[model samples]
Target: MRYIFILTVLLLSFNTFSQPISWVEQTSGLTTQLTSVSVVNDNNAWICGYAGRVLRTTNGGANWVSVNAAPIPLTLDLHSIFAIDSMTALVAGSGSSSFLFRTSNGGANWTQVFTETGGFINSVQMGNAFAGFMMGDPVGGRWSLWGTTNAGLTWDSTNFYLPQAGTEAGWNNAFFFEVTSGVWFGTNNTRVYKSLTLVNWTTQPTTGQVNSYAIWFNTPLTGFTGGTALLMTTNSGLTWVSPASPLPGTANLSGITGFGSQWVVTRQASAIYLSPDNGATWSTSYTAPAGNFRHIAKSRANNLIYYGVRSNGGISKGTLLVGIEPVSNIVPDKFELKQNYPNPFNPNTTIEFSIAKNSIVKLAVYDALGREVNSLLNSELKAGEYSINFSAADLPSGTYFYKLSTGDFVQTKKMILVK
Candidate 1:
């Protein structure tokens, strides 16, 4: 899993912030129900759920440190966690059965590595520190692949090959890995499986998408998902589209992290949207007081965003600005397209627009089923402020859609290459 098409230049500093964004409530003295969360930045973070709870936070969340699973007790239910930083990590569980634990001092002590009883272990991913991957749900009906280069000691659910149908399972935190674009999950039938090289596998069929229950990828062709509806696959999942519904009442989505361009979606027990363009549109950043949210973790060291409120068991932390504010000498009143800076991009990303008067211009790119791969610009500028330097190398990851026209002032935005 090694594909590198580098070139990342993002130096935008206008500072902007607005939108229904607000979430701050962290103090998990445990009430149960935290399904999952793993953030190794912005101060370190880690969380699990139900009975075998295992919370942690280095600083970002203020203060939270309750880690003790000793011989794996407390009844077991830790959905999944793979923190790989603030001192190594890896966790997995599922009530009446299933297990896998590992720690290197951070959690004080843990070391079960693997276990099996009936079925259960919905997600756990680790791309370095000795490779990693674990996803489960269908024991006999297939769908349960494990692999660990070494970190977790030893594991290898037998090479690979997942196709069994009949009642496939998976969707707790809906597993998704990326060491170059390799694992992905979300199945309860609606389908959505992929594998760049986690042992060759591929599936697609979330047509209208339902039961997709959380699957994320900000690169590897940009992805996002949630059960019953709400889906978007810039090509990584093969083909999937239907994005709007961050929480119009509820299509029943559950946990989805963020990266490329901020994101945080969770709508099972209702609201918690928040997308700074990477998801088209979304607002109500956080709103869950009753009982159902499973996961949402992002903190690539500073972005900071964590939440998992299984109804009262609570756990929250926030820091989402949506950047766009700093303005002293701003300029531009009419024509604008700006929405493509650092967006799920890899291999260069930067595109700004603001031509209020000048004429003849084109700039094109589309592919997420729209065709028209690349065009860049067509020319006759001179308006005020501009910024363009888009590059995808040769394209491969997925999701693309850019249009700018000039005369009547058309617009279109969405970019992701991830290769």
Candidate 2:
């Protein structure tokens, strides 16, 4: 089953693998082809698809309401919806020449802020209202990038261009977001590009067409992108290479992104895939909100991944767990388990810890009694950094004990909790 989750608040001090959760169906009315799903935070999200279809819900994915947008004889195909903030957003699509829609009230109303210079506006992105760029297929199959400085009220039309661009049909998607710095991707020399000022589309040459069928970045450098083959670039798009993945037999990838720690990708159906180590490998257990999932969105706020799938057999709801993020603040404040961060904690926490040498580190927790209650970290850990989590919902709420053991280094700490 697929679920489009929405959380209200996010308290992130660290990044860690979060406990697994499922997606819940909030709305079951429309059946148009979903174009883009944008999530600003946990509780705020917007999804726009085909035939002037745009849905908004502030209550996560449990409920949805079509923005009964003030009638304007909806003409342009609303292919994408980008929630820049809970109030601000931008959307664009193909039909009716090419157009963009902006909203400052969570879709309560929308404004046709921009239109095409003659081409199907495949995707739309904005660094700010004063700085924006739109790219799409040209008349002769090539692609062009247009920029703006006046809140998209007017565009500069042409600054970056890609010759003989491939058809966006059946091709993956592209996105320009602020990750570490200004990052952009689509296909350039038939590959991809990354720019700082959204100009001078620097070509990061690659060997694959539609290499990043679906691309997403976390930092300007460290990101996971995939197409026919899964790819990971640690230094922006300067270099490109494929990673060895255990995906379900070279599955046709539709979209890819970094959620929490693992890399999430959608197959064709409601089925999805996950990679834990930057696409070097994959897991078959990954799942998202159930349905004939057409699109998915993830919010860094609450470590939740949502999906918009076709409610199977008359549009029903389902859920799936497709990826894992590290548990933020998983390390006991008094115990110490700090490693790296950006994990998928239920509430998005970070954990850090240090071990001297190899030992039987049993960071277990017991509920009330001294009996072995639950094992948060029960493995032969190395002598380096360690991070783990005692899932909030996995165990009951009460006094818990975390004991670490080595040869001569054995310590136990007590911690309190409130659900």
Candidate 3:
């Protein structure tokens, strides 16, 4: 399965401010400090943590099975995990000799893919099914960066380029990668390094912040990094600034992930903060009863559902009630495509539509030449009124066309981008 880390910008027509999120704590049946969580889909998920503990849930966290039995060392503290599916995954652990393990048979057997003595692998991310990257602490003054093009079957340490590290180290799960956007990672030295080409590098200081442990981007030009403090950027990473209001807690942020205007972050404390309007403001969405959260992840198949792992073996499943709610109880009599809000939009706009019956709908944007550019919606939705927000930050200013299509219905409209 190819995993592409692209944040799709689409908002359903609902009052997100009043949308209630209900979180239920799932039973992990362990007490170890869970470090990272990965949601492959709505039904499959994985969590890794200390003592080489790895857990898997195939039925949407209704039951979690322990997959760390044989051939997996009990002393390794697994820091990060990338789940390709329920039966295949790659996990990296930090120790005197850092190790990367890949399991193809649901963790019943494992193969050591990469190992480096005196190294600590912090993050492992796959851009797609074939290409991936892994980063560890500086080894012998050079960043221990590895790239793999064969789906983690083998890894290459050389040929891939990175800058030297001068006594700085990266935090666990502190990296972001998008095939078209490049890679970024934060460090303990108040600096974040970015490379568009993966060879030429540049650094930007997160001024006044000592550490940046978590980083996420909604678009190529908008992102956020958090640790001891929270910093945001509107023009990529060229500049960073703190939000107008501070996060609810004083603890460091350990995980960050979201889609569209909805943002979620897990702090070192018991609370998970959420921003309904892109990172401008935050409010406490859920507070655990016992330990702090170490990592949070959103489902790739469903944006409204996410999972957060705690420091005490607790997994919380949160569901956001932000789906396409009907404008009224009555279903529409005919299909309609409304004009996009704030036409001649500057980088962002909302397109509304309605369907007369349940159908598989597709809404997409096209360039002036009728080439498909962005796919906003392509799913089986019930008959209702819906609106989706689209971002054109990565597109040049020009005239664009948006088309809505179903099995028996099709419509197209024009919109303009000013900048």
Candidate 4:
């Protein structure tokens, strides 16, 4: 059975093999599609889209302010953006007359960094505050790549690697920048370009012919590149192995990003897939909140994951009630038993409970006939939030009940297991 779940502040939650994550919507005050997002931190981010659109959030998306680009034409589609801080960022627009804009005064002023006629910019990335790179569609049989050592003040266009002989171009949000000066970009050539030392670049073919739209690397040695299916690499991009697609065989992956050690992949408006063990196995954690999910960003300061939608004109914040992060920092004021996530679960789920004061806690699950099937926990507790995993690998799928008892507080919640 398909399972859909939601979480509350009480902290009672669960996760079967198929657990749903809660996505909270953020108002962008615009309806245009936000195609790119660069999360500077938990409280600062920059989002860009069509019509020279740029949105900045400094207070963790509670409030978003618009950064205007008046001199630049509004009809151009700003498909790629890189935010260095609250006041400084770079946005690239794709069209017949592609242009790149930079702002240093928090949008009070804007400057045109570079422009190319009859070209389209697909991705832009910065390795440091003063160094960055940009890629455009093939021009004269060579993909356009430019480097800048002095921020956007000057760009060097003659220092590109040997060009391949094809109409090789890049997809939106297909670029990745590693801290060790590694750069990777997916292309319509069904190949991935990797620059181990940033001085030279090499292209490696993927297992499938579909264009890779998104790419992520947990470490320089481990990464996942997705197009029609998922390809994983353990020894960097030297080799890749095809993993089972998280969605059905027909769905194409739209975007992928990393949240701490966990990974997330989106399939447009259909679903969001989560991988707890790097790129090994994935499960459906939630459906797309709005429109089609184009990209997702995670804040390095607080590790908050944010989703940007295509044509939805808004962004959404999400929280994981299972996997690594079970709850935020808000502690409960009283002992309570909350609901389990993905109540109609499959082979696995999570159980969360809170204690207001230190007490002996006991948790056990029983079958529909009141027979105990599993003892999840029996521990000396603290006045904090705690969660435990409950895997029904050996139990038959059916109705099950879980009870929590601690001092005078005793409560039970019913869950369904459908294998």
> Model 3 over residues 1-419: C-alpha lDDT tens digits?
11111222222334443233456678999999999988888889989999999999998888999998655689989999998877888999978988999988888888899999999999998888779999898888888889999889998887656656668999999998888999899899888989887777789889878799999887888888977778988888998898766767778989998776667888888887778677666766677878999989888777866899999999998765453333455567888888997999987788888878766667778999989776555444556766677778888899999999988899999999997
Q: Give the TM-score of candidate 3.
A: 0.73
State, as a TM-score between 0 and 1, how close model 2 is to the true structure.
0.64
Please list the Cα RMSD from the true structure of every candidate, rounded to 1 decimal place. Answer: 19.3, 10.8, 14.5, 12.8
Q: By lDDT, who's the top model here?
A: 3
Candidate 2 yields a Cα-based lDDT of 0.54
Highest TM-score against the true fold, candidate = 3
Q: Where is the poorest 10-residue window by lDDT in model 1? A: 1-10
Candidate 3, residue 393: CA error in Å?
Answer: 43
- Work out the TM-score per prediction: 0.31, 0.64, 0.73, 0.72
| Deviation of model 1 at 129, angstroms | 24
Stretches off by above 4 angstroms in model 3 are 1-19, 324-419
* CA deviation > 4 Å runs, candidate 1: 1-37, 45-80, 83-88, 92-99, 107-110, 117-120, 124-135, 139-165, 175-186, 191-207, 210-241, 244-255, 258-274, 281-297, 300-419
User: lDDT score of model 4?
Assistant: 0.72
Model 3 collision count = 0
- Higher-lDDT candidate among 2 and 3? 3
* Candidate 4 C-alpha lDDT tens digits along 1-419: 12222222223333312223445567888988888888887678888988878888877777888886676577888999888777888889978777889988777778998988877888887877888888777776777788888877777787575485566777877888865848888888778888866568887788665588888887777788878778887788888777544434346667777644467777666466676566555655445446777777665455444555566885766544444334444556888777877678887787777788755566778899999765454433445576656678778889999999887699999999999
